[model samples]
Target: MNILLDAAQTAARLPWAPLVDEIEALLTDPTVQVPPRTVLPMAAGAFLFAMPGCDARTAMTKLITFTPANVGTATPTIQGDVAVFDVASGARTLILDGPTVTGRRTAAVSALGARWLAPNLAGPMLIVGAGVQGQAHVEVFAAALGVKQFRIASRRRASAEALAAHARRLGLRAEVVDDADAALADCPLVATCTPASAVVLRGQPRDDAFIAAVGAFTPQMVELAPELCRAIAAQGRIVVDSRDAGHEAGDLLQAGLDVDAMPALADIVAGQPKARDARGPVLFKSCGWAGWDLAAARLAAKSRPTG
Candidate 1:
């Protein structure tokens, strides 16, 4: 039997701390399997993606489409479904709203990245882009890493203000800043969640800061500047969610980075040593991977009601 979960139900089942811990276990586990994803480009700025993975016990896949034109309409930019299956019986178990799985799992993965890269980060952190990913990240960071102060920025004042207001209701200190640079000025950590085709921030991040760039999955979109990429790469501290990021992440491509030279998040989580410039910032470029979806889907499936 297949269980179905709407976005609200999916979100309700995933609490940040345990969900983040599950992500951490997946990232650090050497046995988790994530195959290369498939992307099919469609005309007029739309693309279809299929991502599949397994956690030894269960298999799952996330099938999604990105349509840029949806932004102006009432539809969401990302739409699709995630299917979870029993490994032994090969029975379909659950189907979840793709956007909710994507948003929550992505933010959980980013939170894990921060823990591995900068475990001691106390906020006044800056989150650039006040959309769904932005709000999710704020909640994840606060819950997973104990970051309580945030500076939220968006091209529009209202959007930033809305996110900041939400943050304040959590008893956290949050402010909307007009200048992106000023918002990031003394931040120990920063999350760039925009879908800009060009670079968003103008200057380099603080030397001690760690950056999580969760946007810009396509080669055409770039959120981080090349100079910032170069500065972090110089320290040999760049990491990505998956090896496939070499093909999908625009921020890394725009930086002229050799994806092969960057370590996968799993490696970092497993305590594998990579070149590290101790004084430079660490960069975590996430091009959403299949394994995360699988893990999340399994968790959601386990929460299903039983007769």
Candidate 2:
């Protein structure tokens, strides 16, 4: 029987540690195959994304919609489902909520990057944007890295406060900051999760900071200032979650940085010596990848009972 998992059910199966481990394992597995996702423009500044991937044992596809216009509406900005299949027979095995998988898996990738690139996993991580991605990052960082303090910033103060309250319920210290740029000065770990066409975070990050820029996935969308991106490329190192980031990572592209030269998360996961060294602020650009969804599917399948 094919199982259907809603947002909450899907989230319960993908705990931070195991999901991160699955993603890391897939990074080095030669049998895993993930092609670049397809994004088509929709009406009113929205997008339809089809991401597919397969490994030796499992195959999955995530079909989701991105609607930036729904930011304040009752509807979520992202909606869809991830369909998992048995690789051998090509039989559908499970259906998981798309947004939950996207949010959690994306945050897991950032947490994995932090494991290798962060200067320190100390308190007071700064998260720019208080949307779903922002809250997911807080949950992953707090659970996986044991980060206890967070500074939340967003275009909407109420949203930031709400996220802060959520963090407090998780027994973490969280505060709403009016200025994300100012918060950058003290935070050794930072994540920008806003879906902004213009730069949302400006200025140079702390020298020892690890910044995960995960908001912008297209060449036109940008969250970090181009100048700051250039500064990081010049002084520190910029790493990407996938090579596809060369075309999708807007922060690096807008800054005219050669993303082709940046090391990928897979390279880091493989323990490449050059990718391990962090001389200055390390910026991890995550543009989303199908392999991550595949990893989530693998984990979700493991938790379910076999027929």
Candidate 3:
């Protein structure tokens, strides 16, 4: 059965605010064989996938976030769908609204990252890029961490300020800044929210700066320095949402990061390994796992009154 969910209705009933605990508990006791995202280039755009074996349910999705060149027209920033299956029966169960699910689940994943790794995460959070992912980051982090100060930076000052203004309207202390450096300096939990294939952020943190680089999916297209692999190699443990992403994610391989050292988010949450090294400066390279999306969505479904 292919049951489709209304984006608006599903989003409203997202249960995103309450899904954090389930996501955390999942990190502690995982039931899926999560694979890092895969990519297949299409003529118009490309498809990225994160397959979770059994995360409350068996789910796999191909998130097709398009190239910015296409955005010149009215092409959506991200558009895709998720196909969920039954573990025991191997029957197709649900086909979710991919584009909406991607934004919400990805945001939840980053929020979970902030909840577990960001140490002493007080004050100003700087989010680069004011796209769907960028906006989602702000929503998740604000809900996860009781942050007081927030700043949004985009290539366009108007858009950045708009996001800031939105946050403030939501009762969050925030503002939009034209300078990226100032945002990084003010906020300890700095995020790389852009997907552009270049080094973003004014610079990495001075010390113990927690970064969740949600941008930069391919090695050719990276948001931070290729030397970041070396930076984390030296200073802190470079943890990933999933090690499988290391192979699929260009940022890590391009940075000359070794997969052997990369730890899974589950391990960090499970106490299999410590969140950060004694030195500090922890890094989380997120390719946006399917497991997280499925995890968040599955839990959300449980909250609804099923027929």
Candidate 4:
């Protein structure tokens, strides 16, 4: 029998700390298989994405869609579902809500990476973009890193205000700022979670800052400027969640980086010798991967108190 989890149920089950640990474990696990994502363009400017992965005990695939036209409607800009299967029997086992799974898992991975790479995180965290991803990052980082202040910036002030309000409810100090650069100044941590085609954050962050660029999935989309990438790359570091990052992450591609040249997040997590050092401004670019969805879904199955 297949189990189905809605948005609320999934949220209740998969909290930040455990979810972040699960993602951390999955990235370092040698038995896991995470293939590059396949992007298929649909009619009417929509995009269909397929990400698949497997572990020793289970496998899963997530199907999601991005429709630009759906922005103002009741439907979300991102819509999709994930299918989980038993690795041994090859039978379908669960179906998880894609949006919730994607949002939380993505944020969890960002938080996990920050936890390890930027161990001394402090001061205000600048969150660029005030959508679902923006909110998720705020919640996860506040809980995991104990960040006391958040400066939420978006092209839309109303959106930023709403996210700041949500952040306040979480017991963190948050404020809406019209200028993204102003928010970046003196901020120790920054998460760019927008889907903008052009760069959203300008100028250089503090030398000790840690950046998580979670938006700009396509080759034409970018959230960080090429100069920022160059600066971070000069340290011989610009971490990414997957090997396919160069191909899928526009922020790196635009900076003239070959996807294959970048180091995988797993290697850094495993404590490889040449991995990124603790000093300098560290940038973690996430282009999305299937293994993350698989890990989150498996955790959801185990975390459901009533199930």
Per TM-score, the best of the predicted structures is: 2
- Candidate 4 to native Cα RMSD, angstroms: 2.1
Q: Candidate 2 — which residues are off by over 4 angstroms?
A: 272-277, 304-307
Off by over 4 Å in 4: 272-277
Residue range 1-307, candidate 3, lDDT tens digits:
2267656645653555666666776666546656655566656445444444465455555455555565425777676666666666777766677777777777777777767777657867888888777787788777767776777888878778788888888789887877776566567787777866566653556466677887766556677677765676687667787765666556677777776467777777877454544466767788766667767556645556233
What digit string (tens of lDDT, one per residue) describes model 1 on residues 257-283? Answer: 898778888777677453333567788
- Candidate 2 C-alpha lDDT tens digits along 29-129: 89999988999999999999999999998999999999999988899999999999999999999999999999999999999999988877795899999
RMSD of each: 2.5, 2.0, 3.2, 2.1
What digit string (tens of lDDT, one per residue) describes model 4 on residues 3-105?
7877877687788888988988887678888778889998977799998988888889999998877864798988889888888999887888899999999
TM-score: model 1 vs. ground truth: 0.93
TM-score of every prediction relative to native? 0.93, 0.96, 0.86, 0.93
Which should have the higher TM-score, number 1 or number 2? 2
lDDT, residue 286, model 4: 90
